[model samples]
Target: MTWGDGDGFVTCELGHKHWGRYGAAGLLPYHDGYVLLQHRAKVTIGGGTWGAFGGARRRGEDPVAAALRETAEESTLDASEVTLRGLMHEDHGGWSYDTVIATAPALLEVRPASWESKGAAWVPVDEVAEHNLFEPFAKAWPRLRQALRRPVLVVDGANVMGSRADGWWRDRAGASARLRDQLGAVDRYTGIAPFDVAIPEKVLVVEGKARNIGPGDTDVRVVSAEADGDDKIVETAASIVAEGPDVLCLVVTADRELRRRCVAVGAEVTGPRWLLNQIAPKAVDTPG
Candidate 1:
């Protein structure tokens, strides 16, 4: 109810003590072959140790926001400079720590901005294990490192919308709008190939009558396609692939031609089930 009311400590189901009543989150900033890490001050918990910049979540804050805010508070890196890829969650029954992984390219400047951190540096991915790291972070590093590359999930809106036999045929625009809203709240779920778990930057490609469902500040970006939704989805995936070989581009659709086109451009493909399994609870049935 109140902002930052989640201050203080709480015990997890494991009987282990942890900070943050609403749970904690951290930002793992990766660039090129390196990941930015923070060293705890001698006066702080697990002092003189290295880990990602982060802290407790506020009462109403999402994990992503909490991660970004905490990193901003502890480091001089500009939040806008980073592009969040996805999150890796460590659940301890009721309480959990979500690590939001993002990228800012190579050689971006980052400095320690708070007393909680004694120092900051960019450590190579392969060398992260060589350094003395915080216990929890050390445990999660193996899985986190595999997801260093941020992915772009370009969706075939019409195709995905058509997959559900929920009366979308009657009102295409309204159905697309409903689908977009549900996608905004989706979490967890592995994105595509090479990424064991992730939440990609979602781009919903809508065309025809659904084209009017335009941009917003929601979790999903509505891209009203000028022509075919399938073409736009493939184009979006190609553009992301153009960013770099390391950048992941996954297209969500079962359309054979579209899937082939996306794969032709060095992108991965998955059916609607890949998304529906995660967002189905959020997608309300079309009223009869």
Candidate 2:
């Protein structure tokens, strides 16, 4: 229907049907390197256990929106104060729930504001393993750790092509194909580039004719759509920042407006050269 319209539920016949009937969202709030977790009330399922703040998604709400809403309802923290990281997992089967991970700039003073939680507080990065944690969260924790450190890279293919001085307009398909092949090769050959810290996610957005260029077998995820790639990139970045606390999003483009929009939402911006530099190979030996 529309944004906020109630979509029907989806069910699976898997064993141990749990957390079904309603979709769910969660806030993996963070500050610095630490994360905020909630302890469920003793009477609740998986109660007296530490987990991210989350609950059933409301009809008409996307997972990220539902997550922020749930976090506010379950804890005293305001939803607007947090940044989304991205979708960590979509646990489907007998019960389906999307885990929306996010981060905050500060260690919020969290307390149970509703019946779902008994206590809420920040857990140090090193101490996450000490607590009795929910099973799904525990199983996903290692992957999540890696994901949180990865940064989403949003590229403006059109802008980047223009920068190449290759007359892409005369051969849009060829230019796009060359770019995609280069990117794929970069993914295959580049050693994990050192980041100040590890990055857990890398995404590339392509639009127009370039949209047809897929990510191929690369490790990076690609979003190719007819829509404004800049807008799509912004939305993706915003979603990730909202759901995962440890992740960062860096949009690559020269578009002033798009850059501004992303920065306003707590995402970082880089120029097209950053991506081009990655694919540029170093000088090779020409020995006889």
Candidate 3:
């Protein structure tokens, strides 16, 4: 076998030899209660067993990027076809393996693209445990299954902007537009709870003068309130939660009444400060 960068093995603090000099990462793509699993070739270590498509992380590579690259090299699906959802990390002392959880819009056709794989199949979630799985993957499956739910981040534009003393009151529409554009630049969000890492479906609610602002460059959906912003925020959270129990909603607002209303409908509530810290870490004087 040709030794490439991150190809060699290293012993972790746990005294186990593992592939990749830095660390390893894998992709777990799921859709409609099924997950894409790779069948290992007989020549590989876990021969004839099923696991995720993955390998060692390259120098200076992000874990998610490594996972996507390895998956593309070993499978027929491209990174563009899947949307990142969350991340789960397993650290074996100094060594580690990162699992990037993603969602496919639909179950597109997939098969083994490299010799390392014997085949590939979309296995049902419940039936996954019946197969002889790779040892590491098997151990991680339980937690991974629990985290399959997608995250929805609901932003209270009026509340969040009001909390900031950045002259938002002077130009409400301009401020909303700025916030929308800034949210577009954010690539990932650290999960609040019940989620390890979150790449959420962002929703921003605007009312009054800011209602004219539309969707920005990012995935953020701007919802213009017909009436009260607080009422719209609560409705949005309720609508999202109603999609499924697996859909996690986190509403950002400092309004106690709004928080109580959102929480009543199975949505998690956080203050505006939590969001300010994410979008504008440098901005000071942000009040909850």
Number of backbone-clashing residue pairs for each candidate, in the order shown: 0, 25, 0
lDDT of 1 by residue, 88-123 (tens): 888897578989888885657788888888889999
Tens digit per residue, CA lDDT, model 2, 89-153: 55565455656555676787777887878999788878888889987678666666554444566
In model 2, state the lDDT of residue 266.
Answer: 80
Which runs of model 1 end up more than 4 angstroms from their true locations?
A: 1-11, 15-17, 58-61, 170-199, 206-236, 273-287
lDDT of each: 0.83, 0.66, 0.87
RMSD of each: 4.1, 13.4, 2.2
The global Cα lDDT (0 to 1) of model 2 is 0.66
Query: TM-score: which is higher, 2 or 3?
Result: 3
TM-score, one value per model: 0.77, 0.54, 0.93
Candidates ranked by TM-score, best first? 3, 1, 2
Give per-residue CA lDDT, model 3, range 1-288, as digits (tens).
224488778999989888888899999998979999999998887899999999989877899989988888888887899988888888998689988889898888898988889998999999999999998899999988887778889999999888889889889999999888887778577745655677888999999999989996677899999998998999999999999866889999999989999999999988887787777887748532
Query: Model 1 lDDT vs. the true structure?
Result: 0.83
